[model samples]
Structures are given as structure tokens and as C-alpha cells.
Target: MLWWRQDDDERETDDEVEVRGRSVLVLISHYFPLLEVLDLSYPLHCYHGAVELSHLKKLRKVNFSGHSDINDKSLLHLFKSCKVLEEAIMLHCFDITFDGIAKALRERPTLRSLSFSKTNGPVKVRYESAYTTSHFISSLSLKCLASLDLLSSNISDELLSSIATERLPLTRLVLQYCIGIVQVLGICCNIRHLNLSKCSMVKLEMNFEVPKLEVLNLSYTNVDDEALYMISKSCCGLLKLSLENCNDFTKKGVNHVVENCTQLRKISLDGCHKVHANIVSSMVSSRPSLRQITAPPTRTGAFSARKVKYFLRQGCLVC
Candidate 1:
């Protein structure tokens, strides 16, 4: 039941305290069996304490992100102990390899939201193989997993294709900066919120259908007018869309979205040079449901600015 640390007069150096404090915490876990939520993220070197996590059967949510010492063995111990675990965020835990991640997923079928991105260590040799990564994702049981974030990872298009084929019941997926994904050929039909920002290789002809999609972000990508048109046509239920720095799109693409995506309440066209001022004005006039529209100051002036002001007066947010 010891909750507080010793007085400052008796405290050791930071390194010694951190190392020794973790050991104390692990020892305390043996006494307090009801410990449910544990966050060992940032600055806490839990290389040894992680193994002791198996003792907390009541643990539900855990965050082990940015712990340099957390490896597959630590994860194995965690999954083995926290069978009822629901959410686990392990971003930048460099020591965790794909094998460890796969094993954890297999053991904890109740994980609903999981993030393992940016976990690749400084040493490139520790990176997981594409095959192992793909196998783990595809093999995930479709009962509990609903949200997954894999930003800045080395996941390839082949793995994406496998995920598409598996069609797991994922609702939200983030794949920002995943350069290896060149196309998304209708793999995630059930996805409602999707972010593919900075995926430079995704081109105009890349075909994909996500009918239930509501929120989509394709910022800083190579998505052109044709691709935007395709998205508007397919994801008609889209409520929020961001195309920031997507310079390949023009007025034609914006028009398609304004015309088709009637459910759209918010849209961002910042850094888009070809979407003229008049087109934006036209869109504002047409789409009464539009609440927020973010565009460059140069393109949003005179008529567009006046329309935005009017919307603001009417209690809508237009920027």
C-alpha cells in the first residue's frame, strides 16, 4: 500500500531513483493486485518492470510508448497476465519486434484499439519482416479490434492488400507517412475514418471504395482531380475531408465533392493552387450544410470572404 516516494533528503540520483523506483513499483504490484491502468510511457525505463506486468490480471489499458527497453518478452508477459486488456498503445517502443507484436495480438483477443507505429528502433536490423507483419495483421480475430493506428511505419502495399482481403471489422485506421502503400484498391470497405497523409505514391487512378467513410485525410499526397472525383463518387457519406497540400487537384475536383458529398460539413483546401476563388464561392452558395472550409487567404477573398462572413453570422464556422 506504499503510494508515495521517500523525502527529497533521502532521494538518490535521477538514474538510480528511476531504476530503483521501477523495482519498488513492481514489488508493490505484488501487494496491490487490483491495479488496473498502467502507463509506463516516456522516461520510465521499464525493461524489468514490464515482465512483472503479468501479475496484474485486472489491468485494462496500458501505454508503453517511448520505452527503449520494452521488447517482445515484456509484451509477452503483459499479454499473458492482462488477458482482459482492451487498449494498448506502444508507439516508439523500439525493442518490440514484429514477432512480439504478433504474439501479443494472438494472446489478447480483447484488444479493441492498438497502436504499434514508430516502434522501429535506431538499429535497422531489428525491423520486422513484411511477411511477419502481414501475417499478424491478417490473423487478428475480427471480434474486438475496431481502431488501429500505424503511422510512420514500414508497412508495405502487400500488407495493405492482405488487410483488405481479410476485411476485419476495423472502423478507424491511420496510415500516415506509410510510403510503401502506393495504392488502396478497395481493401477497407468498412473503414469510417481514414488518414493517408504524406503517402506520396498514391496516385489518381488508384481505385478504392469505402462506402461508409465519414472522415478522410489525404494531406500532402499526390491525389489529383480524378482521385478526388473518385472519392466523392464512392464515399458519398463523407462528412469531413482534408486535402491540404494536395496541389494536383483543381476546381474540377472540388466541384465534384461539393456536388456529390452532400453530407460534407467541413473541407480543407489549403495549399491547393488550382481551386479558384470563384469555385469556392460557388460551393459556399450551393452547400448550405457546409460549416467549415479552410483555404488559402489568396483564394478566399471578396466574394468568398463575404460568404464566409455571412456563414459566421449565421452561426456556422467558415475559415
Candidate 2:
């Protein structure tokens, strides 16, 4: 059975080519019984197939991003049919609603990763639906779900609180551009990788703690020095951190991170003009495990140039 298809550069025009209807999917279902992955992302033509996807029991991952026709009904059909589905990526699928997602999560116990990010539709309707969906998701027992990507969505602190209450064993979570989130609270302790990049309004609450967190991205956010200190104290296991465009942090804040987060191996200070070149150089010299540091070019001074050269000779990748 063909696992994937590569589109040819030269294809026949409509007059010369045979247009396949939705039955093509049905035919594939019968033929490629072992197909584990299916990607109908931005299909060349609209698919009007009402084919039962449940028949393809072996299907594990599915991507229907940019498919305008696939609505809540299509999702429901997939949920009821594909019993072993692990990942569902439906970015920009405008027709999907809260009801469909809630039902799917409840039915698919094996689902571990879901990304409904960047679904731009009607503004008022989307927020209302997203709020309801988040509430429903928080109430469920999703032990198998480890990764969730909700970038550019209307997620608020309420959704975060719900996830925390459930204590879902999520290891990776992405909430970039979730503008409604003002202060983050009630995050699960199991989260190891988190991306809150571009969430400018978000401020890390005092009680926030993620003991097992290893990778954290707070670039372009409003997080101040106090927030950084709190994170350094709480997330001592952090290995990689990004503070790009966080102008609020100065040398003191950066030093706090370097001292408290002893496990940090990589850090980014890009666009943070307040964090002087000398402090960055000293950080690299002090931390033996630190291997990579991304920051703007150092000011052209005799002392700064010597420090840069010293770090380069010490085998650190300074960018």
C-alpha cells in the first residue's frame, strides 16, 4: 500500500485530467488498509466525500489544516471511526466548533496531541465557542494527552485553571499569542516544555511553579525581573530559556537566572538591550555547562571586544 503520495511538477489540465470525486477516499480506504498517517492538508481540490473514516482503523495521525469544507461533522465522523487516532492537527479549519472537539476528546482516549491553533473565523462566535470548549476539556480526564498547541487562540486564565485542576499529565504546552491570558496560574507540574512567546500581557504569578520544566520560551512577553526570579527559584531544572525582546530584564535579572538556574545550558537575550555585553560574557565564563548564548552584537569597545574573543576561544557559541 502507498503510504504517501508525491505530486508531480507537470500535471494535466482539467480538460485532459480526470477529476476524482469523494469516492477516491473510499477507494483508498479499501486499498491502503494499513495506512497509519493521512494528510489532506490544503488538498488540490475540495473533497466532498462523506466516506466513513472509521473503516480505516489503523489510521493514527490526521491533518486536515486549511480544509474549508471539513466542519464539525467531519471531525465527529473521524472521532467515531478512527479509534486509535493519536494526533489531530486542524489548523485554520474554520468550520470546527466546540461541540465537535469536546466530543472527540471524550471519545478518543488514545489521543495524545491536538493542535487547533490559528483557526481564524468569526470573532465573537469563535471566542464564545472556544470558552465553552475549554471548560469541557478541563472537566475531562485526559491522562494520555501530553502535548497541546493552542497558538493564536482566545485562551484565558480560566482555561489554564481548568487544566491545572484536572492535573492532566501534559508534558508540552504552547500558548503563544493567547492574548486573553493576563496572569498565568494553576499550570500542571508535569509540563516540561512551555512556549508563551508573544503573550505580552501575561505575567507569571507568584505561586507559579513547574518543577520538571526543562525548556521555557517567554520571548516578546511582559514578564519582568520579579517574574524571572520566581521562575528561576521554582523551575530550577530549566535547561534552556529564551528571554528575547524582554526589555524589562537588566543585568541583575539575567544574573539571577544564571545563578539560580544552574542547569541552564542555553539562553537567548536577543533584543534585550538593557542586558549589557559584559554580563553576558561573564555568564558564559562562569557556567561550564552553558554552550550557546544568542544576543545582539556587542558594542565596539576595547574591553567588550576582548571579552567576546575570550569567550570565543573558550569554545562557547555566541550569537
- Total clashing residue pairs per candidate? 0, 1
Query: Cα lDDT of model 2 overall?
Result: 0.75
For model 1, the stretches where C-alpha displacement exceeds 4 angstroms are 1-15, 27-32, 44-47, 119-128, 203-209, 299-307, 313-315
lDDT of 2 at 166: 79
CA lDDT, every prediction? 0.74, 0.75
Clashing pairs in 2: 54-81
Query: Lowest summed lDDT over 10 consecutive residues: which window, candidate 1?
Result: 119-128
Winning candidate number (lDDT): 2
The Cα error of candidate 2 at residue 175, in Å, is 0.6
Cα lDDT tens digits for candidate 2, 1-319: 2332325564756433224534567777887777888876766655555344557889888887777677777787787788888998887776776557877677787789988754542243256555685666775777899998876677766677778777878899887776777665347778899898987478677575667999999998877788888988888888999988888878888878898888888999888877787676688867767878886435754345666677777766777
Evaluate residue 196 in candidate 1 and report its C-alpha lDDT on the 0 to 100 scale. Answer: 83
- Following a full C-alpha superposition, what root-mean-square deviation does model 1 have from the true structure? 3.9
